[model samples]
Structure formats: structure tokens, C-alpha cells
Target chain A: MKKMMYISAVTEALAEEMERDESVFVIGEDVDIDGGVWNETAGLLERFGAKRVVGTPISEGAFTGLAAGAALTGLRPVVEFMYGDFIHVAMDQVANQIAKARLMFGGQAKMPVVIRLCACGAGTREGAQHSQFLESWFAHLPGFVVVAPSNAADGKGLMKSAIRSDLPVVFVESRQIYYDIQDVPEGEYTVPIGKAEILRPGEQVTLLSFGYACEKARQAAEMVKDKVDVEVIDLRTLKPLDTETIFKSVEKTGRLIVAHDSPAMCSIGAEVVRRVVAERFDYLDAPPVVVASKDVPIPFNDELEDYTVLSVQDIVDEIMKISVGII
Target chain B: MKKSSVASPSAEYFYRWMLAIRHSEQKLKELYIDHKIKGALHLSIGQEAVPVGVCAALSDGDKVFSTHRSHGHYIAKTHDIEGIMAELLGRATGCSNGYGGSMHLYNYEKGFLGGNGIVGGGISLALGAAFSAFYQNNGQIGVTFFGDGAANQGILHETLNLASLLKVPFLAVCENNGVAATTPVEKSTSETDRTKLAKAYKISSLSADGSDVEAVYAAASKAVAHLRAGKGPFLLNLRTCRWEPHCGIIKDTRDQKMLDDWRTNHDPLNVIAGRYPELLSSELRAEIGREVDARIEAAVAEAMTAPAPELAEYKRNFGV
Candidate 1:
């Protein structure tokens, strides 16, 4: 096992995939020389050369569409959106063109394109534009494979799987955990898409989350360990959701608390809770709770941003509330 | 202008392809009116020369990305009338297997990257294809066809700049069909000369009479040559007219006199046939017309009899 930062894991995965596949190429703003704003694609330009490591004009719609086109042909393109919020600028290309290409074309085309978004949330204090986790928006789309890995190991493994998949993937990497280090397995291995990882196993209640929020869920689980036994499941893949894992956990625990950095309304947490309620209604010991960011835009102010974002305490409170009789 | 005494076989082929598109569009219009074909239908009735001419200059390995008014482009590129007909009829045998109707038609083997419903959607897609060709050191180019409506979209300018900067083997063919649906080019953009947009990006461009198939072919050939020679991107503004409404068989709100003038003087088939009267003689014209009609009839028969896509197939595609 090799210890690496979450950002380095992403870069390593890209380098490894490019080395393995001749068709794999990197394209987007500041990706070539700049090595991406977060340096997630560092060393790719030198290794792959100018042809593969393409630095596009700051035209999100054009480059994103271009990546779709490249993917349509023989090339496998990994598009880096400097920030996840920039996806809105190229919404038509991302939501309509790339995502809908395969299904709309009757599966004749394989959209093996990976869109890497450096999704920053709350604590960054980059204001409403830069700090927003919009995974739910893409998760709602039909033809997208949404992945949000919390740590280095899963980051490397899942990215490899995403690049190798035939379908278009929205790979969301949180800037909050860019430097977070973890032991990634040596050499090649892929964390399969559409599977949830049980980070910590317990029996009292289930604490489900993804991306950076998984860190907070683990912390919350640790804090409430003595009082309430909590099972934490990091949903590595958001779309084609690992519902089987979630259902099994909810069925065991009989209580659930979904968490994420995105807004509570129309969030991944909402979907998780909705599914659990619809499927495992009889298993419920108490009403489920979704611990998520407020419905307002993430604030620029530090205090306001902290208030707007989901906190570890919030998860703890939800666990305590649901564990009323048990505790 | 230098004129040939006898039209070459290619010219004759262009003439036949243009006629096929014209007849197929007319058949589609009739089917739509009779409630045979449902959903949206955008026909390139008078603008057949643009696709036929541009496609004539492209090699077999080269790719073509087209806009919503794509019947002409699809028919010209693949000559798969039955595939397109079946697609519009939502049959399992359709080019896109009934998932894509009149707006979306794909044939990857033939290098037709399918038609996009969005106005300027295919511009950058073609650029990517060109980029791929350039990367692989393959002698292939990608040609994207858009109309006046899509010319104003930001993606077009963005793609032009990128294509020029990257020096990819890309061709942007703007079929300037006077008006974009109901909005005239004059009303949409102050600078109506679309070639200027390409020139601003330092990309070479040319303007051709879209009504004349030979003229379009000549200009497109120059553009394709420039692209194949690693001369970066080139844009061809084919000045043409839209005979039908933007979508469906609706009455055109344009000046009747203008439409009549275009139909009378600038009809692509008439312009080509008038130029090559001997090559497309009355006997040959009748024979070609009979052949085109028979093909259209066969395509319609196939589409009419083909089965609608099963729900299980749709479910499978949805997952895929």
C-alpha cells in the first residue's frame, strides 16, 4: 500500500489509465500546462504530450461537447471542469449532448467520457459559485454515472473504473479533501461502480453519506459510539446508487440518517431517505432524518458558510434523536 | 465561370443524391400531413445542395455531424433512406432503432455521427472527431453542418476559436438558409456575413451559392483540401433558402413573393439540372426520378411494416 493524497490519487489514476489505454486523453481548461487548478492532472502534459493533454479555451460548452465528440469517435476523453459550478455554463452539453448521446442514439455509441469536477463545498469560503456540491443535479439525469469518492483509495480505484466504463461518468472530487492522505493499494485495482462501502459497521442506526461528508459521518459515528451504535456507509457511486447496500443496512438498523454537503431539498440524501421509506417502511423504528446543507446558496462569509453547511454535530444530533429509546 | 461541356459522373451522382433528398423530403411532408409520421419534422427542402455538395467532397472515412434539419445530410452521407424512414416511423429497424426519430439519425460505420436536435450542438463534437483523427495521424476529417439559426449560438464561435488554435482537421459548413425559423439573419446578428466570424478566428473561409450543387461542391472541395493538408479549420458559408417551416408541415410566415422567387429561381435541383441539361436530359431525368420514387416507396414499405421497438429493448437501451 502506498500513502497518497486524494488529489494525487486522482492524478495517479489518470496517469495509469493513460499509460494503459492509447485512446485515453485529458482535455479541459488549464489541464495541460497548468495541470488543472487543483493540480489533479499534474504531470499528464509531459507524459502524454500535447496531443493527449489538451488545454482548451475557457469555453466549457465547446470543450465539453468536443470531449463528447472525441468520445463518440475512438478516443476516451477525461474532461476537467475547474469547478463543479462551471458545469452550469455547459449544462446543455453535459445534460443533453453527452449524457443523452448513447441512449438517444439507440446504444450505437459508447460514451466512455469521464467529467472530473473539483466540487468545493462550504468551508472553502469561495462563495455560492465555487462552493456548491451539485451531484444531485447530475444524479437526476438518466445516462450519467455519478461518483463521489471520499478518500484516496476509493478516489484512485473508482476513477479507474469510471475511465474504463462504457457510459459517461460524472466524477466529483471534493477540494475539501484534496490533501487528505490515505493508503491506496499498490499498482492496479478498481473499486467497482454502483457499490456502497461500509466504512464502519454497527447495529443501532445507519449514517449514510458521500464525498467529504463521509469524513464528517465517520467523525459523528466515532463521537456517538459509546451511546449509540452507528453504521456508516460511504456511497461512492451516487447514480445507479448502491441501493441494495443501503436497503440492507437500513433493514438491519431499522433507523437511518442520510447526510451530504448539498442542499436538503432534491439532494442525494432525499433520494436515499425516500427509497428507504418506500421500501423498508415496516423496518423503521423512528422517522428517518436527512442531515444536509440548507436550501440557500453557500455563503461567502466563514460563519454563514459554516452555518449553511452540514456539520458533524448535526449528524450526532440526528443519531441521538433517532436513538431516543435506545440511548 | 468555367463550365464543363458534359457533366462528370460525380456531378451526375450529386444530381441523383439531391433528387433523392428532395423526393424523400416531399414524401415525409405528405406522410406528416396524412398523420403517418408523428412528432417533429424539419425538412431541408430547398437546401439539399449544401449537404450533397459538402458530403461529395468528404472521403469515406471522414465523419459528418449534422443539425436538426438533417434528412438531407443523412441521405447524402449514408444513402440509407430505409434507415432514416424507419427511424422517423419509430421502428426497430431504424438507424437509431426507433429511439431517435426525425431529429436523431446515427450510422457510425459510415462516419455519420448522428444529427443533433440542439442548434449548435454538433459544432464542437465535429471538432473532437477532427482532434481524434489528428491525434491518431489518420487521414480523416470531421465536417459539421449547421444552419443560420445555429450560427448565432456561442458554441459555434467557441468551437471555431478552439478548432483554429488546435489546428485540427475540421470543416464547419454553415448552411445559411436566409432565416432561422421565423427570425431573419439580419434581425439576429448585425454582421450577417458569417464568413467574417471564421476569418476573425484566423481560419480560412469561403462563401458558396447553396442553391448550386456544383458551386457548393467546388467550395467544399477547397475547404476539405485545406483541412486534409493540415491547414487547420475551414468554414464554408453556403447561402441557401429554407422552403419549409422550422418544424412540421406548418405554413411559412415569410413573404410569399420571396419564397416564390427562391422556389422559381434558386431551387437546388433546377439549378443543377439547368446547368447540366445534357447530362440530366429528359430521358435520364425521367429514369432517375423513377428510380428515386421506387427507392422511397421501398423505404416507406419497409418502415410501415417494421415492428415498433419493444419495451424490453427500450429498458435495455435506457440502462446502457
Candidate 2:
């Protein structure tokens, strides 16, 4: 096993995948010579050369659509959207073309494209544009497979799986956890796209989250361990969600709390809560809760951004509220 | 119109294809009026030469991405009228299995990528295909066909810049049909000369009389040659006229006199027939028209009887 940061793990995965498959190439703004704004694709240009590691002009829609086109013609293109918010610039290509290409073409085409989005959290004070977790937008789309890993190992494993999948995958990364280090397995290993990991097991209530919020959920679980037994689940894949794991944990705990850094209204957390309520109504001890950011643009100030986003205290408080009498 | 040294065989081939597309479109119009084919139908009635001419310059391995008014492009590229007919009829035998109607047609095996619903949507896609061909060192090229209206879309300029910078084997064929939907090109942009769009990007540009099949074919051949020689991308603007409305069975809102003048003087079929009377005589043209009509009828008959796509098949496409 080798210890690496979350960002390095992503870079390692891209390098390994490019080495393994000739068809796999990297394309985006400043991804080649600059190695990416976050260095998530560092050293790819030298290793893969200019043909495979392309540094595109700042035309997101064109390059994104170009990547989709390349994917259609038997090349696997990994598109990097410098920031998660920049997906809006390429939404038509992302939501309309890439996501709908396969099914709209009657499954005649295989869109094996991976769109890697970085800087997907609020605490760094990048303001509304740069610091938004928009995975729910992709999760709502039908054809896309959305995956957000919270740590190094899952980051490496999930990225490999995403690159090899026949369908288009959206890889959401958080700047908040880029430097967070963890032990990734040596050699080759892949985390399945639709599987969730049980980070911590307990019996009182279930705390499910993804991306950087998973780290917060763990902290919240640790804080409430003496008063309430909490089960923390890292939902690695947002769509084709690991509902089996969620349902099993909710069924065991008899209570649920879905958390994420994205907004509360019409969010992935809401979808998770809805599913648990609809399917596991009999298994519920109390109403399922969604601990998410407020439905507003992220502020530029550090304190204001923290207020807008979900905090560890918020998860702990929600857990205490739901486990009041049960614990 | 400049005279061309096009051969007799090529002239006949172009005439036959133009007639087939014209007849198929007219048949589709009749079917729509008779409540046989439902949904939006955008016909390239007078603009058949653009697709036929451009496709003539492309090999079977070359990719062609087209716009919503793409029946002509699909027919010209793949000659799979029955498959496209089935698709328009929403049948399981359709090219896209009834999922995509008139606007979305894809036949990958025949190198026809698709006809996009959005304006300028296929430009970048074609660029990618061209990029793939260049990256793999394959002797293939990518061609995208869009109307004048789509030329104003931001994606077109963006793709042009990218294609020029990347030096991919890409060809952008803009069929300037005078108007975009209902808005005239004069009203849409200050620079009505669409060729300047490519020229600004430092890419090679060419203009052709879209109504003249020989001229369009000649221009397309030049553009294809330039692309094949690793000369980056080339933009060919085919000045044509749209006989039908932008979409559906809507009445043509343009000036009737202008439309009549175009039909009389600039009709692609008449232009070809008039230019090549020795090859496409009145009697020969009549025979080709009859054959095309019969094929369209047979395709319509087959599509009308084909089974509708099953719900289970659609559910299977949903990966979740």
C-alpha cells in the first residue's frame, strides 16, 4: 500500500489509465503544460505527449462537445472543467449531447467519456462561481453516471472505473480534500461505480454523505458516538446510487439523515431521503432528515461560506434531534 | 454560374441523387399532410445539392454530421431511405430504433454520425471525429453540414477556432439557405458573408452556388482535398434556398415571388437537368423521378407496417 493525497491519487489514476489504454487522452484548459489548476493532471503532457494530452483554448462548450464527438468515434476523452461551476458553460453539451447521445441514438453509440470537475466545495471562499457542488444536476440527468470520492483510495479506484465504463461518467472532485492523505492499495484496484462504503458502523441512526461532506459526517459521527450510535456511509457514486447499502443501514438503524455540501432543495440528499421514506417507511422510527447547504449562492467571505454550507455541528445536531428518545 | 468540366457519369449520379432526395422529401410532405407521419418535419426540398455535393466528395470511412433538416444528408450518405423512413415513422426498424425522429438520425456503421436537433450542435462533434482520425493517423476526415441560421451560433466560431488551432482533418459545410427559421441572415448578424467566419479563424474558405450541383461538388472536392492534405480545416459556404418552412407543415412565410423565382431559376433539379441535358434528358429525368417515387413509396409502406419499439427496450437503455 502507498500513502497519497487525494489529488495525487487522481493524477496517478489518469497516468495509469493512459498507460494502459492508447485511446484514453486528456483534454481541457491548461491541463497539458500547466498540469491543471489543481495539478490533478500533473505530468500527463510529458508522458502522453501533445497528441494525447491536449491543452485546449478556454472554450468549454466547444472542447466538451469535441470530447463527446471523439468519444463517439472510438476515443476515450477525459475532459477537465477547471472548476465545477464551469460546467454551466458546457451544460448544453454535457446535459444535452453527452448524456443523451447513447440512448437518443438507440444505444448505437458507446459514450465512454469522463468529465473531471474540480473545486466543488464552499469553505475556501472562491465565491458562488468556483465553489459549488453541482453533482445533483448531473445525477438528475438520465444517462450520466455521477461519482464523488472523499478520499485518496476511492478517488484512484473510482476514476479508473469511470474511465473504463462504456457510459459517460461525471467525476466530481473537491478542492477541500485535495491534500487529504490516505493509504491507497498498491498495483491495480478499482472501486465499483455503484457501491457505497460503510465508513463507520453503529445502530442508532444512519448518516449518509458523499464527497468532502463524508469527512464531515465522520467527524459528526465521532462527536455523537457517546450519546447516539451513528452509522456513517460514504456514498461514492451519486447516481445509480448504492441504495442497497443505504436501505440496509436505514433498515438497521430505523432512522436516516442525508447530508451533502450542495443545496437542500431538489438535491441528491432530498432524493435519498425520498427513496428511504418511500421504500423503508415500515423501517422508520422517525422522519428522515436532509442536512444540506441553504438554497443560495455561496458567498465570498469565509464565515458566510461556512454558514451557507453544511457543518459537522449541523450533522451532529440533526443526529441528536432524530435520536432524542431512541438513544 | 461558372462552367464545370464534370464527367457525364458523375453528372448523372448527382442528378439521380438530387432527384431521389427531392422525391423523398415531397413524399414525406404528402405523408405529413395525410396524417401518416407525425411530429416535426424539416425538409430540404430545394437544398438537396448541398448534401449530395458534399457527400460526393467524402469516402465511406469519412464521417458526416448534419443538422435538423438532414433527410437529404442521411439519404445521400448512407442511401438507407428505408431506415430513416422507419425512424421518422417511430418504428423499431428505424436507424435509431424509433428513439430519435426526424431531428436525431444516427447510422454509425455507414459513417453518418447524426443529425442534431440543436443549431450548431454537430460542429464540435465533427471536430472530435476529425481529431480522432488525425490522432490515430487514419486517412479519414469529418464533415458537418449546417444551415446559415446555425452559422450565427457561438459553437460554430468556437469550433472553427479549435479546428484551425488543432489542424484536424475537418470540413465545415454551411448551406446558407438565406434565412434561419424565420429570421433572415441580414437580420441575424452584421457580417452576412458566412465565409468570413472561417477566414477570421485563419482557416481556408470557399463559396459555391448551392443550387448548382456541379459548383457545390467542385467546391466540396477542393475543401476535401485541402483537408486530406493536412491543411487543417476548410469551410465551404453553399448559397442555397429553402423551399419549405423551417420545420413542421408550416406555410412558407418568405416572399412568394422570391420563392417562385428560385423554384423557376435556381431549383437544384432543374439546374442540374438544364446544365446536363445530354446526360439528363427530359425523358431520362422523368424515368429517374419515377424510380425515386417508387422507392419512396416502398420505404413508406415498409415503415408504416414495421413494429413499434417495445417499452422494455427503452427501459433497458436507462442505465440506472
Candidate 3:
């Protein structure tokens, strides 16, 4: 294993995938010469030339549609929406065209397209329009496998797996942890899409989360380790959700708290809580708690943004509350 | 009304195709009125020359993206009238296995990438297909067929700009039928001369008489050459006329005189039949018409008897 930044892990995955398969190409705004808006695709153009790495106009609809057509034709296209909020602009292509192509065509089409979205709200001063964690929209879409990688290792692994998959995948990466260093396996490896990783083994409370917020849950678990045995689960895949892992953890701990950066209503947390209540009601010691952002647009002010979204302290408090009753 | 003095392979086949499409639309109209076929239908009755001319220049490997009025485009590309009729009838053996009706006809094996219901939606998809052709280094090109109404969509301009910038092998064909559904181009768009819009993106553009099969074929030939030479994207504006309503069995409610004038003077079938009566003699026309009728009937019979798709298959594609 080698230590690397989350951004480096992303770039490394692109390079490795492009090298492994000639059909893989990257298309998005500022991806070619500009090396992506956040430099997540740096050195790709130099390594693969202009044919493999193409910079497109700011028209998300066109590029996203183009990526879909490219995927249908033969090439595996990894398209990037510079910001997660911009996914709204490309919704027609994503929801109407690409998402329905496989089923609408009677399974003749395998849409091997990966959409890399820089997602998550709070901590970024980019305000309401640019900062929004909208993975719920894609997770709800049919014919789409949504995955969010929290650390460098899963970031690289999930990206590789996403590129290789025969179905459409929305690989949601976080802007908040782009520079955070983590130990990633050197060379080639892939983490499966529909599986969750158990970050800590405990019996008192179960904390469930994905993406950059998963780090906060793990940290929160560590903070209350002396007083409570907290089990942290990183739900790497949102769709085809790793319900087996979630159910098993809930059964062991008998308490659950779901955390995410997106607003609480109609979010991933709601789905998790609903499923646990419906199927795993016998396993719960108390009603499942949810730690999520308030259902309000993220504010521009740093302090207001902090208040609007979840934090490590929020997860720690939720776990502590659940632990007191469970024990 | 200039006609091609010389009769070649395309001339003979073009006349037959125009006749086939015209007769097929007439059959569809009859079926809808008889309550045999259901759902929205966009007939390319008077605009057969545009697809025939454009597809004449395309190789078997080239991909074609289409709009809702896609029967002519699919027939022109694949020459599978039976399959198309079965698809329109929503059969188990249809191109999309009865899942896609009129607006969603796809035959990837024959290089017909199929049609989308949204206006101007196919443009970007076609551009992406062209990008794939370029990426694969397989010498394949992408073609998109949208009407004049679709030209006004913002995505069309965006696609045009990017196609020019990328220098990919693509052709964006605009079937300027002077109407977008019921709205005339003059009412919805400022620049009625739609080909001029390509100039803004610095892409090569051409204007063709869509009613004149010879003219459209000539323009398409030049476009194929331009694209083959790696000259980026080319926009072809085929100013044709739509004989039927934008959708359904409803006859056009537009100006009767204008429709009559076009049917008389600008109908591609009439133009070809009038220009070369000897080539399309009564006997020859009757034979082709019977062939098309038989094909459509066989397809309809098969489709009417074919069972609906299995629930398991539907669920699999639904990915639920």
C-alpha cells in the first residue's frame, strides 16, 4: 500500500483504466488541456492524447448525450459534470436518454458510461447553486448504479469497477476530501459496487454513511469508543444498496443512526430508515435515528453553511444518544 | 423542377423507396382509421427524398440518429419494411421487442442508432456516436435527422459548436419541412434560412431542395466527401414538405391550397414519377407497390399474432 491524496487516486484510476482498455475515454468541460476543473484529470491528455481526453463546451446536455451515444456505439465514456449541482442541466440526457436506453431498447444496449460528479454540500464557500449533494436523484433512477467513495482506496477501486461495469454508474466523488491523504493499494485493484465496508467493530450503535461524510462517521465512532462500542459502515454503493451488510450490522448492534450531507427529506437516510423499520424492525432496540443536513438550501456564509449541514460532532452526539439506551 | 437527366442505381432505388414510404404512410393512415393500430404516429409522407438521399451516400457501417418521424430513415437505412411495420404494430419480434413503438426504433446491427421523441435530442446523441466513430478509428461516420423545428433548440447550437471544435466526422441533416408540429418556422424562428446558423459555429453548411431527390442526393454526396476528409461537421438543410400531421391519423389542418400545391408540384414521389414516367411506368409502379404491400401485410399479420414480451424480460430491462 502507498499513501496518496484522494485527487491522486482519481487521476491514477483514470490513467490505469485508460491504459488497460483502449476503449475508455474522458469527456467533459475543462478536462483536456485544463486537466479538469479540480485537476482530477491532470496528465490524462498528455498520457492519452487529445483523442482519449476531450474538453467539451459548457453544454452539459450535449456532452452527456454524446457520452451516452458513445457508450452505445462502443467506447466507454467517463463524463464529468464539473459540479454536482450542474447535473440538473443534464437531467434530460441522464434521466430520459441514458437511464432508459438499456430497458427501452429491450436489453440490447449496455450503457457502459461513468459519470464522475464532484458532489456534497457545506465547507465549500461556493454557495447554493454550486454546492449540492444530489446523489439521491441518481440513486432513484432505474438502470443506474450509484457509488460514492469516501477515502482514496475506495475512490480508486470503485472508479475502476465503475468503468468496467456493463451498466451506467454515477460515481459521486467528494470535493471536501480531494486533498486528504489515505493509504491506497498500489497497482490494480477494484472494490465491488454493491458492498459496504465495516470500518469499526462494535455492539452498541451502528453508524451508516457514504462518501466524504463517511469519514466523519468513522471519526465520531472513534471519539466515543471509550464510552460506547460504535460500528461504522461505509456504504460505498448507494443503489443496489448493500442491504445485507446494513441488516447484519443493525442486528448485532440493535441501534442505528444514518448520516449524510444531503438534506434529510427524501434522502438516502430516509430510504435506509424505511427499509430497516419495515424489514429489520425486530432487530432495533429503539427507533432508528438520522443525522443529516437540514432541508434548506446551503447558505453562502461559511458559518451558516456549517450549521446547515452535518458534522463529526453531530454523528458523535447521535451515537452517544443511541449508545446510552442500547447498553 | 429540374430532374437528373442521367438514370443511375440511386435513381431507380430512390423512386422505389419514395413509393414505398408514401404507400406505407397511406397504409398506416388506413390502419389508424380502421382502429387497427394505436398510439402517436409521425408520417414522413412528402419528405421521403431527404432520408433516401442522405442514406444513399452512407455506408452500411455509418450510424444514423433520427427524430420521431423515423420510419423513412429506418427503412432507408435497413430496407427492412417488415421489421419496421412489425415495430409500428408493437410485435414481440419488433426491432425493440415491442418495447419501443413509433418514436423508438433502433437497429444497431444495421447502424441505425434509432430515434428519440424529444425535439433536438438526437443531435447530441449523434455527435457522441460520431465521437465513437472517431475514437474507434473504424472510418465510420454519424448522421442525425431532425426537422426545422428542432433546429431552434439550444442543444442543436451547442452540438454544432462542439462538432466544429472537435473536428469529428459527423453530418447534421435538417429536414426543414417549414413546420414544427403546427407552428411554422417563420413564426417560431427568426432566421428561416436555417443553414445560415451553421456559419456562426464556423461549420460548413449546404442548402438542398428536399423535394428534388436528385438535388438532395447530390448535396449528400458532397457532405459524405467533406466528412470523409476529416473536415469536421457539415450541416445540410433539406427544405421539404410534410404531407401528414405532425402526429396521429389527423390530416394536416394547415393551408389547404399550400398543401395541395406541394402535393402537386413538390411531392418527392410525384416529382420522380413526373420526371421519369418511363422508369416508373404503370407496370413497374404496380409491382413495387404490391411488393411493399405484401411486406407490410406479412409484418402486420406476424405482429398481430406475436405474443407480448415476457414480464421477466421487461423487469430485467427496467432494472428494478
lDDT per residue for candidate 2 within B1-320, as digits (tens), equals 11223232388789889888888888888888887788889999999888888888787788999888999999998888899889988999999999898889999988999999888889899999999989887868888998877888888889999999999999999888889998888888789887888889999999999999889888988887788878899999889998888887787789999999999999998888887788888888888878888888899999999999988867765733
List per-prediction Cα lDDT, in the order shown. 0.89, 0.89, 0.86
lDDT (C-alpha) at residue B283 in model 1:
87
- Measured over all alpha carbons after superposition, the RMSD of each candidate to the real structure, in angstroms, is 2.9, 2.8, 3.2
RMSD of 2: 2.8
Task: Indicate the TM-score of model 1.
Answer: 0.98
The DockQ-derived docking category for candidate 2 is: medium
Better of 1 and 2 by DockQ: 2
Give the per-residue lDDT digits (tens) of candidate 3, residues B210-292. Answer: 99887898998888778877788999998989888888766666898999999888989778777888988878878887887
Per-residue alpha-carbon lDDT of candidate 1 for residues A29-99, written as tens digits (9 for 90 to 100): 88876677788888888888998899888999989988999899988999988888988999888988998
Q: Model 1, DockQ value?
A: 0.78
Whose DockQ is greatest here?
Answer: 2
Question: Lowest summed-lDDT stretch of 10 residues in model 3 chain A?
Answer: A318-327
TM-score of each: 0.98, 0.98, 0.96
